[model samples]
Target: MLRDEIITVFGGSGFVGRHVVRALAKAGYRVRVATRRPHLAQDLRVMGVVGQVQLVQANLRVPASVERALEGATGVVNLVGVLNESGRQTFSRLHALGAKTIAESAAAMGIRRMVQVSAIGASATSLSRYARSKAEGEASVLAALPEATILRPSIVFGTEDSFFNRFAAMARFVPALPLFGGGKSRFQPVFAGDVGKAVLAAFERDDARGQTYELGGPGVYTYEALMRLILEAIDRKRLLLPLPWAIGKVIATVSELVGALPLMPVIITRDQLIQLQSDNVVADDAKTLADLGIHGETVEAIVPSYLERYRHHGQFHEREA
Candidate 1:
């Protein structure tokens, strides 16, 4: 297998990181899963042959830890990101400075293939601090590793994703789902597996180096439509309430405060509200999965399979008499 060469994956224990790690392992690449808690990543071992995957504790906030993770690695991928600021893990610190630290270390090691996972709305001038920090991360990465491949994906959906799972759970409890912005916010949700495959494809081509790709699913869905799908899949009915920006901001502010408690409400944050105001689809001009010769999945075709568990009678109940 070609993967005998070491490929270090930063944040490999995370949601997207797990998928990427499996994909890389399947491609026959030796993988090093780097995260703050290496013990939690023991599950990653089953993805590859015994000893093919190693988990190392690496914190990007500390340059020494990040540099140590990069040692003797031919390739590196950065998948570290956060939705909200928790204590010292601020947006600037984690997204911007953390990315710089990792990329700089990779470049210093002369690693040629570096993949960075970012979001579609990452812009230095964006309204949300999350988006702005993402843009800063991109810039810092490019500054250090000019040939790094950056992938900015739309809302990623999978069985374990927060997007659909949150709404599905909300349908179970709340009679009405409060949308951040009038339920008109648009998104093209890409499958996480597709994004992982794209990362590997990008790693194979030097042409992909120094370039950015935007990945999206085949269908573009409004927030209201998305909620309706979740309800239908979960076999629960609910009202889709459009939250005006002003009301949403206030609610988000309160939610942020409440989430500070020992047990968080899992509520959306102010930055997330700001993000919903903007479109999250891939730009027409950008290279997408299709450009990479990959056909993308639609939410309609894929989501129901996993969501069946939430149905009234479960999978067996769906059997026709």
Candidate 2:
């Protein structure tokens, strides 16, 4: 809420972080986008006034680099998270340890306003390593900086999202869209723009510190229904194959192997396959986007805006934006 405040955002170059940066910049805040490679996120510089947004090369895995990134920052937002392990970027290292370093560093620098972005299914006792690591990361962050706000989002969707875009792209050429666990799992997808606003609101509210908020969209849809919606949105028809967990795991294994290539597309990891077994809707009685005073946009309104490119006639096709 305060103008001219300095806020450093980790993972500002990511799908969700870009929107968050834009929101912060529009709020008249000086934002420092810290990522592993500063050059890759150069576009973030244009999101704010001439010099309001700056980029710094910092990897969460290293404490020293994180310390340097937080110099002269009134607040910090950790949007850094990994879906799959790639060599040293494992779950424990990035999610758990990386989060701790940021929180502790912020605390050391007397930065009271810190927000950490976590997933919806994070649990210490979860069967999935990613989930467990996320739990560990949350615990680590709170332990270090008790005032830090923790945000847990369920399937964040946006113009450049991996969820809607991936499936829509596959529908372009793939004969069938694989439905994990018979596509029975349910999800409450949130818009990235809403999430960005949520981050800003959390930082402005004093009560938000030390609190955890679960963010989701207006509607909850089953995986199969969502797939059908995407098929309809793109104006394309394709087989909707219900893949068994056993078969999905095998494909996940092969995908992981192939994903190691330098330019390989991100395939479904085994942990992601496991994540599909459970529903990702907001918990009963849990706080949500409404709690932040944000009327989260529905997937119906946002998805078609960008997914039109995947259609047969691209944007030439007549459909709602």
Candidate 3:
């Protein structure tokens, strides 16, 4: 494969997208980051040489914008997704339709390579709208171009991630943390960088074409166990309350309502509660990080480096080693 090929990445400024872009740049690929806000993606220019990286304003909802972004790109990656529905970013619009638009444009424009980043629990029949829309996106992409690659990753974590960061932030101020469904739901917390590497690997390997890869870390932990891991990382001792499913739903709904206010953090949404009903881990006998030739980063090694910032001393704490 030519390293100098142009690759257009939708949502390239996102948590995982940023890492993917960095990895692609390091691998010698010129990257075009297509996002709704080119201003926000300005920092990506530094990822590559003076002009190796370009940011183009493209909204997937607008087919014309999607097509323009694909111009002069041999490879494309769709990382656009939403955890919750906001003003105009609905799951159906962003995940399903957006992916379809990109896939169709790539196919029509004769773009040979593409990849879609989706979650593990995505299903056409899923109760969670998030999961269902992701499934829809995968299906729509394949319908347009059967050779397009698809990746389904478990809960992705990093210093900038909403998963561990959200809880760590809450632990800093809240007296207690709530665990939905008794925290029994399992998750394989893959590192964000690992996910990026996997994306690049998929693009490099011909065998990965038209195949779905389920990406997960080396270890799996329950919801409660992961919470405890966060607590240990932050060196904070707080009650881990196991809230009932019904009660958790109520709280999540209230939180979304509060999000409607001027300046409220987007806490868990009702769709998230619905997603928690299923374990977010790679399925048995399925190809995973190992198949991608990736030894994913562990929670123990990576989580601490970032979570240390949330510690009492805030990066000044003495290291045991």
Candidates' lDDT values, in order?
A: 0.88, 0.91, 0.91
Ranking by lDDT: 3, 2, 1
- Residues 88-204 of candidate 2: C-alpha lDDT, one tens digit per residue: 888998889889899999999998889999999999999999999999999999998888888999999998888889889988888999998899999999999999999999988
TM-score of each: 0.96, 0.96, 0.97
lDDT of 2: 0.91
Backbone clash total for model 1 is 3
Q: Which ten residues in a row have the lowest lDDT in candidate 1?
A: 312-321
Clashing pairs in 2: none
**Best TM-score goes to which candidate?**
3
Stretches of candidate 2 above 4 Å error? 318-321
Point out where model 3 deviates above 4 Å.
318-321
| lDDT at position 278, candidate 3 | 88
Q: Could you tell me how far off, in angstroms, the CA of residue 197 lies in candidate 2 after the best superposition? A: 0.3
88-185 per-residue lDDT for model 1 (tens digits): 98999988999999988888888877999999999999989999999999999999988898999999988888888877766776779997668998
Residue-wise C-alpha lDDT for candidate 3, range 1-321, written one tens digit per residue: 326689999999999999999999988899999999999779999988888889999998789999999999999999998787888999999999999999999999998788999989889999998999999999999998898889999999987998998999999999999989999999998999998998899889999999998999999999999999999888888999999999998999899999988889878998999989889999997789898899998999998788888888888976454
User: TM-score of predicted model 3?
Assistant: 0.97
| Angstrom error at residue 314, model 3 | 0.7
| Residue range with the least summed lDDT across 10 consecutive positions in model 3 | 312-321
